[model samples]
Target chain A: MKNPLYLLQRALTYLVLIVASLLSVFPFFWLLVGATNTSADIIKGKADIGGALIDNILTFFERVDVPLVFWNSIYIAVTATFLTLLVSSLAGYAFEIFRSQVRERIFGGMLLMLSIPFAALMIPLFTMMGRLGLINNHLAIILPGIASIFIIFYFRQATKAFPRELRDAARIDGLKEWQIFFYIYLPVMRSTYAAATIIVFMLNWNNYLWPLIVLQTNDKKTLTLVVSSLLSGYYPDFGVIMVATIFATLPILIIFFVLQRRFVEGMLGSIK
Target chain B: MLCGGERFDLARTGLARTERLNGWMFIMPALVLLGVFMIYPILWSLWMSFQVGRGMNLSFGGFANILRLTQDPVFQRALSNTFIFLIVQVPIMLVLALIFATMLNDSKLWGRSLFRTAIFLPCVTSLVAYSVLFRSLFLADGFVNDFLLGLHLISEPIPWLADPFWAKIVIIMAITWRWTGYNMIFYLAAMQNIDRSIYESAKIDGVPTWARFWYLTVPMLKPVILFTSVISTIGTLQLFDEVNNIPPNAGGPSDATLTLSLYIYNLSFRFMPSFGYAATVSYVIVILVGILSYFQFMVVRDKRR
Candidate 1:
């Protein structure tokens, strides 16, 4: 089945794929190598690994309140993820199962809102936060994001694949709607939850602009805000910055790896 | 039988009422949250856009901020820079993603999964981390410059972040690197769902590879392409993280990389808190996205007819 032309095409595909992959993955590798080199060496464009990882880590920890900031990010992300999934998924399920003309219109409106840039909403949201006395509060970060339109859309789309027969059988067996959603639907859609968890958590963790505005003090900063401000310092250390960036990136990376298969499946479910 | 039928009908009606109540219950939390967080803020911002203000001292001056927006040179710069990035970068990224996706969709391709994973990894990368990596990599004496210089591509190192023109290129490259993979995943997913038999029959008809791709794979991927383009348009217009992080100042080198989102940030936070003017700039983004997306959908629809 393989002719000369076919072979040439295959070779060309392989070459492009390889180059693209390297280009895509090289920065992460550079991040790792940069963490191991001194700031001076990094400035000199040193590519080789050095034994400066410990020093970089120490420098980073000393410069920042590592535990408090880490906890701030983790708390916000986890709480936001949990609430978003619970609220949005419930709405999604309802939108699918209990469809109505009015509800459908609401759903369309939500999609349009999703397109409205969050920047557009920032000032008023900031004002509302101020009114509620939530300035410099982590709740300010977590609350606004809980009703995520994208997650709702994803869950609604994914719910299309849920079997109607299961719901029917549960109804016949005396299961209540909420009970069926909890006992049956929730268990079945664990993979979707896993996928959404990674995404929502990542977004919350890397949330820069809103958190930057709301969380005012040094002690309240997330890793993202902290890292960004770190760059603006009088003498920014790339090695220390690398170490902090790696820390900031590590949790999401680990979550991605652990749920990689489910994440892809989750994406497939949404697009369908 | 008549009595039984009447009872069944009553029960069904009762169940319908219950379902309606349950539906409201399920959606109540989201709706309430949206009301407080999204809807209210949106309305307030809309109102704010009509007012003239600095800090908290505000007065309703209808159309003042809108008029200011017309005359604001920084807004003009940011608007033009945004369009340049949108026009230049979006197509390049989308086309590359499409090409990569098609090539990878070949079932006979070896190491397909590895390549897919590698390419897609960039999208999940932390914005701060990637921005830092890119800034360093494109430094005058950094890896990218070193490699280019070694290959004799240029006689001197390019001032990627320092220069106005090159700064825009650096931001584009950064975003393209981060998001091209995300777009490719969508295309790849869509391509897989496409009937392979179409390609097989086309091959049997002695269709050239390029023709088969152009006439076949592309038409099938239209909906997905449209969806990505609209989403990408919104994302690009809201481009902040890359520009804010890559440049020395958030929107720097004389606002070369300043975007609408960044301008809004500057007006509100950096420049004595012109919330009204900031809100005005924000609406500009909304209008642009609205228009571009409408145009994109129209184009897609026209192609179908």
Candidate 2:
């Protein structure tokens, strides 16, 4: 156990791990510490905590309605996450459980559609949104992204890993297809739903380019668009931006921490 | 399972067929929305790629637009830059991810899950926030310069955001930092499927650790690696955000960070409305992704052979 070779190996692993872990956590530390400093101090590369946290936060509140923006972001994120799970999981389960050639072709078509750059379609999509008079409505942002191809693919894979016995038993019990999907499949796949909830929420919450292009008014803006405008000003307040980022990222981070066990397994299922 | 009499019976089965129709009805909403939004725009952009016009009123210029792409210096520059980012960043990120996955896979390694989560944190951070952090850190008087100066490695601070070469490097580094963790999440998930006993036996047979990794894990993780590579290639080619954010302006320092996607953005938004050319540029990205994805599929197929 005291072998010098073992000691050397442990030392090397620890060094690599420590350096990597530090690099990963350093920006987060910077974010936290920056919030405690002023704009000038942050720009000057001040590393220690300053007494500007209250001032920075107060200035942030004065500049932006923190409560409204936070609510806007959470509402959009939650609704989008919920609908995406409901829509995509149903499609995915149907695709896997009820196999058909035509649906397979439809899935293939969706896959190809996934590769089309969202930027290319933004103008047309915006035009359509405006035509439908949904411009500035949160539905304008939520509707277009309801059927995420990535999430659909994810649920399809997870469905494959599902036990067939459950479905067969449900059939024997005379549960309607919808009922079985709702009652049996959904409950057993809580872990998958958890994973999807985190990912879909993260994506919808952080979505920037589309929302920036579509949502014109300040009230319609999500946390990401708000943050983007916040930084795009003549002089970005890094301290306050850091605070906003911390707030914006907290929900996803909390979800990730809570559901990581299922998340990793879901990722494996999806990828393979 | 279904043939002859039973096949006919199932086909004529009203109740069962109604259930099957319900399946299509279930997916109909997604399909309809995607068709109007995705398919129609894609076809429209493909058409716009052909027409050479600046504004809404336009006449078809046929292949003249393609000819312009051949001669336009900025377009040519963007094409090359996109290719460069695609070629360079994908490999580095994938390799780093694979290495991290391997190290983290070793159950003997201390703090495996913690390391994985920490490494994966950057991807979860918002694009704007990460960009702000990078811009500040790479500024002339930023932490990176201070660190280098303190280490006595560089006599003067490196012009990270100024020079063209360094600008590209910074974009690549920014991308690598943000995405390597994301790709590692995939690799880590894939690697967990691998049987540990294989590695254990390899160790027992005195296979060198490096050899074991090179021979065992790489082969086992090939499919997922290909998956990450294809996605990374597409992501890098559509490399708008990093360049747009890291540079002073959108693509700054004499257009060093000017990418195809950014150039397309400039055409539609920053510059005068050249919707046709922007649509043309968007088609180029579609083509690039199509070609790259096809080749990756081929490679994966061949590897399976």
Candidate 3:
């Protein structure tokens, strides 16, 4: 028979794990339940799912222009993600494949730049965007984020695993440099691209601070800004706010679940 | 034969030149964007910090903004509040993450994937979405208060957003909830790479579980722990989204949750635009990150020897 102490230890482990799992998952349940309950029932601390989800969704749609904000978010996120992956991957590949003292120093400088908070850069960036007359434009949001330092760093790390023999073979076959990159490197590193796509897309989608500052017009705002503005209203219907929150969170959640393994690997790729 | 050798040498030089050009061609786009967006803005902000300004009308006043940072009560409050968060929350979150990682690292644990997925789910939500959820959940008459009262944990409902202390508590709780699992993922990844033989050897000896954890696992995971700490430190120093969106009055109930980034936002945008002062405030975060990161590295280094 197993020792009593070992059994107790196992029980304690399960107890702690169960408690943690509950705490971690409770907020999501609260979010879904809150979406279905009216403001009164939510305030009354009702835990069970209610039947007001349709009403809440309708109210959110009525208060906000759902299609425009979603378009803004989607357009910016997709364009930004595509450009970030393409540009950063090329840079990452070049950084790894080509060795030079000057380029390595520049790469080091970029790493240091990662620590420079966005708060510090916002004032000047805003002024620059204003001068270009790009204020309230989705391009303003997409342009600056296209060369993300963190993504470049991640791609550089991932690129270390790319096979040198393939590049050599491609060169021997008379494939041009850019041609090899387009045909061989791109397809071979599709998993890295997948991981980076999810990450960059999520960042661009949920981006708040810069977008909040730049996008002045209601028609130009993204879903994040719209949901935030919903709460600032006088009797923020918890139900409606929850609906909007769910709408904002759903796409990223779907992408994350679908590409869950790559997402985790992508996160690991950075620190490695 | 000499003519043929000359031609081959020329071809080698031409190929090297083309390779160099290709390298630059590949990186030029990203470099140009970074220069315009990151490098130029960094220099401009540094220069702007020295220019005393209101709105766009400005004059260079060296040390003026820095002097204002000294006397400004709001700046001091934001600075102290940020430090308090860094000191208290970072350790709590990191320790919890380390513990959860150690526990979940066990292959024998049942439902391990479920627990891991659930814990990690919070990190996927947008900052604003989670903030709004937390705000509603922690309202004075909200579910948290109702649940606590039902459990007889407290006699009266807590004013989570309205009171200063409770508001800070709520912000800390919110941050911990969102980030602990994120840090845990890093530790978990690091833990999986550690050789299982070491733990097995320790088990064969009389070393207890806690001692094995303290002596073996913690030391092995030092680099990852240091990495997560620095990232957490930087994140806390720039804490804004939750504070900005969670409280009824962004950093409200007497600025208890006011962080440096939010203060910078307020100075530049919310109030009469003090662009110079805000730039100076932003530099405070940069400096804090530099200093704290140095100390963290130093501490880790000293422990190694």
Candidate 4:
């Protein structure tokens, strides 16, 4: 607690930061440099780029149906993202805007549901999906998550900032509820939607456990599941696996970079 | 001012009624969908919990599953493993997150935003990607072992994913690597919200940096700390993806990483469809969460003035 010890602690703090930062960001760098190295060099801990970048790309394409896998990931992410935003935001808006005693109790119950572990319900959920005859279908992954409690809570929190005067003005202009929601509310909340899109896309794209259980074959599998299966093999290839991880992780990184500014802006707004 | 008093009151009442109706209309679809998907399945599971199962052959055996849960070895292993994960991982992550957030919060630090974003990079990484990547990086002949060998830190490779003890260590490291930054973001957000006046006063008093953090920052941010711990507790309790994906659900050479969630999965699917038994096992998780979180909530409440 003395000044000399304080200075030492400050120095220690900075040291921890640099080391932690390197440890956090080092793997991505490894993946990038590893991608350029040959399968043998990569496994041997080569940290620099080698001449195998083109071959790695070609090999990735050759072994896995790269385009199909990419498309499957993209389609699932986009569709799930869109539907989740629509359903969750709609309910979120209604929850905050329409204050009633009964609705308040319902919202409270839903919040409690948010705290339940998913493992508690996953089997029963799978049973329901099975009964609906939706096994091996992407809809099984897409549907159950559409009413995500977290996103709904987020939107409700954000909607508190929306002005009541705007709603009154729209009503005075003879705009119906649906018309106001579509033309005014929807257009005004673009940043919120962007943030939600990135988060939801990441969830859908990287979704593993559920999709792994539901999806039956290689052809139907997403990139995440493929990487999992690759690791599960008897003689796993670290070099090939690193390449797979890089490919699997790139889209989400790209998405985060493109929309990160918006996410922060939205975070400030929602939290306020 | 323009309307008669009785007419205005009547119109206001009508508008209030219509708003209530509109509210119900808007939420109806989500409510119905949730009921069918979440609420209905929960009730079904609750029912199934009562019916004893052997290979999916269900027969009503009242309270039988609950009695069986008290004696199951696998369930006991899972409960203990889950507790170990929560107790260890949450504190390590929270401390790492707090330190990182504080460091990143300093404006004098160069590349603060980049470090913040990069630190957060793991959270958005695909789970399977990292799981596979960690398994390989810590493999017997892989990068971590080779690096340690070159530096003369270890006489031999550490068998990270093979041996029971080391496998748990590798899993913990993998989890910590992936989630530390995510939690750090939460702390960073909360720290930024804190007023600068408090820290400035502490500095002016010649209070040590560690004392300033311990006495000033922590008590102020107790709510956020409590929040992170609760979420982490729930996450670690349902610790499946990392174990299942990384070690490919075999857990290890001797199943050291077998978590409650993974056990529930095995019981239901990998084993011979002991749906009733699996339900019983899952309820054990619910009970564990319920008990631990109750104590945590009490601690948080006692902290709050």
Best by TM-score: 3
Chain B TM, per prediction: 0.94, 0.94, 0.94, 0.92
The lDDT for every candidate, in the order shown, is 0.87, 0.80, 0.89, 0.80
Q: Cα deviation of B281 in candidate 3 (Å)?
A: 0.6
Clashing pairs in 1: none
TM-scores of all predicted structures: 0.95, 0.94, 0.96, 0.93
User: In order, what fnat does every candidate score?
Assistant: 0.67, 0.43, 0.72, 0.61
- lDDT score for candidate 1 against the true structure: 0.87
Question: Largest lDDT belongs to which candidate?
Answer: 3
Q: What docking class should model 3 receive?
A: medium
Assess the local accuracy of residue B146 in candidate 1 as a C-alpha lDDT between 0 and 100: 81
lDDT string for model 1 (B1-305, tens) is 24467779887888778988998899989999999888888888888898886999989999888888888898999999999999999999999999999999987778889999999999777787799898778766778888888899999988887899999999999999999998999999889899988899998999989999899999888888888888788889998888888887777788999999999999998879989889888888878877876776576678679
Ranking by lDDT: 3, 1, 2, 4
lDDT, candidate 3, B59-135, per-residue tens = 99999989998899999999999999999999999999998999899998899999899888898999999998898
- For model 3, how does the per-residue alpha-carbon lDDT over A1-272 read when each residue is reduced to its tens digit? 36898898889888888898899889999999999999988877788999999999898889889988888889999999999999989999899887677899999888668788999999999999999999999889999988888888887888799999999999999999999999999999999888888888888898999998999999999999988988874367889989989889999899878888988887677544
DockQ of 2: 0.57
Candidate of highest DockQ: 3
Clashes by residue pair, model 4: none
| Candidate rank order under DockQ | 3, 1, 4, 2
Worst 10 residues of 4 chain B by lDDT: B245-254
